[model samples]
Target: MRYVTTAGVIALALGLSACGAGGNDSAAANGSPFGDCIITGEAGSSPLNLISDGVVTVKADLPSPGWYNGDTVESIKSGFDYCLLANIAHRGGAKGLNLQNSSFDGLVAGKAGSFDMALNQITITPERESVMDFSDPYYESTAGVLVKKGSTLTQSDLADSHLGVKQGTVGQMLVDKTIKPAKAPAVFPGDAEQQAAVAAGRIDAGIQDLSIVLGASVQSGGKLTVVGQIPTHESYGVMMPKGSANVVAVNKMLKEMKDDGTLDKLNSTYLTEAYGVDPTTIPVWSF
Candidate 1:
């Protein structure tokens, strides 16, 4: 339902038109299926049609720290996901970014409408594939148990603790399929609510991504801590509309980033440097 075209395409596989909208010769030479760059923008030419010509539409939950950063949606500036998208557009010859605000449940449910892609630490699963598309895995993650500092969650309450989880996340998946705690877990709209529940003693612990829990713990100034990690061993990927034409291009860009070590550098910059928590020290909590 949204417009999609290669960025900076000057001619339809020929050359720049008077209006300067077409295809990239290099892309055509490289056997790009889109034929040519049929658009023009501040960036160069590419071969894929995106949600918008000359711009990439990236769907995300505003204020997704560690993944993407902003005091608010309007203030987003830098983070792991932001840098990844910038490089993806740079490689594809797109020069613009339109960050669409949406919910995590919407993203996983394939209902976050009209964006080229979504990247909020999403994990790929076979069930989700029925309704959406996913690029090759870009990053790996595990679930962590967040508890108030000095809470007796691990020592004596493993089976009876009332857990809290962010809706539509691997944390919820773990609760439903693995943890099987004595009581039904409280599902929150987002991590902030889950963290609040834990802070208020409303839930014994909150389960979320290790990196996410670490960020929340640090921000809490020792009021919260990661008590243990669940070895979900999940890999995160970019989510797209089912059978989108952009999948090939997106995967190609991810492969290039992985091969060139750009992904690792981004991880270091945002995850390690920005969050400042090491996964190695976190104790593993087995089922």
Candidate 2:
């Protein structure tokens, strides 16, 4: 896991703590029952704890099933997840939010009937929209490939190469639907396996989120380099069951966060500040 250092976390925490409640109509001002922000559901319907304190306690799913925090077991921290946490903290302070770890299969299978939110870069699509309520996109992503530094791979030649991607990720979708590799692409179970394959010379390149791949590249000790961004227009959203009670409140908070520049600050703190990758520097390609 290419995670942020302890200093990064501390700095981010302090920065958020210093944020002033600015939006004209905050979640609290909207008369939301859940909290000053969104309400996932009524008491017991979701992980949100209904209490007199008016704080929202939510159980959010991990990036994938069985995934745990790399930095702390008591927390579900990741570069991507950290962005979400930072935004929430900036908007209403951490006191109003409580996050619990869960899995992809659990959320999708309804195993986490009590969980309130599932984020982990979950893309918002019309198909998923039919069964789930999604907040306005918290993050937008583009696919990217990681290759051995100095390697001569390019987007145009990807179709003839053996690319690696996680089995059920959008990277896999990009490879299958767009890149359309000449040879069957090497499918790994997760980022670790796919990254390992790239490092071990088992695969020519690995495809995944540009931000993720860039983080991996920086942590690769010069063994890997990001190829560039693939323009797939992927937007990641926070999800809840269909007709989630908190959708309105959540969307309200999200909109305020966007308008207040909290989202951009979070993006910089986690992605660029921690990983040192300038997203704009990466070239973008269209399928």
Candidate 3:
């Protein structure tokens, strides 16, 4: 499977910044006031601090088992917080907020005044953005096909086979829309479960995030190979209540991270390491 290296990611970040600055300031300025401060549900001890009204509060929202186990969540959170602090230092103050980790349904229902922003691995879709505001994406990845080593399938050889994917994820959507396989099966298992099924010959192939699939493949001693990639162009972003002031603050921080190479570094540390891939070779996704 192809991989990305740190140097390559740094170049991509520079290229993105040169092409366009992220965040829509006009949208943020036209939105709601920044008054309330809270982080409803997050993992571990409160690693966030609010700087407003001459008060600083630290709160914790513990993550569920599934959330805490993934490298993507941790990496994104680190980059988010790092950018946030820089923004606060340069911009005077920000509304403190954190997202609660609940089921997808719980998140969609809203968490009252718990947090002003949520940083889960939320994929941006027109249907979702219609109800909630989404910051510029923090991470971009494509779907990939995982098969046993030495499989005959090439990157384009799986259009007619039975493909497996976790139900309700970008992976599933990519398989449905991009691959349009002849016999796609809905495999609603966890990442580990789906990977295990592929390894055990229960399925011809499994569709998953490139990061997760590559990470698991390395952990299994190269027993699997990613034979195909789906060009669905998925991304993860910060979900905020529509018209929140915090949007500006978050975007500011994100841009700074991009400028200083912090974003690329974080991706290298967590994602590239997990997948045993060099950060420089990660494909660039056009914004």
lDDT of each residue in 7-88, candidate 2, tens digit only: 1221111001111111111123344422222222123222222321334344443322111223332333334454454344
Worst 10 residues of 1 by lDDT: 8-17
Candidate 3 lDDT over residue span 93-143, tens digit each:
433222223334234334324444654445677766777777777666565
Per-residue lDDT over 118-142 for candidate 1, one digit per residue giving the tens place of the 0 to 100 score: 7777878887888999998887767
Candidate RMSDs in order: 12.2, 10.1, 11.6
Q: Which scores higher on lDDT, 1 or 3?
A: 1
Q: Which has the higher lDDT value, candidate number 1 or candidate number 2?
A: 1
Instruction: Order the candidate numbers by TM-score, best to worst.
Output: 1, 2, 3
Each prediction's TM-score against the native? 0.82, 0.70, 0.61
CA lDDT, every prediction? Answer: 0.67, 0.55, 0.47
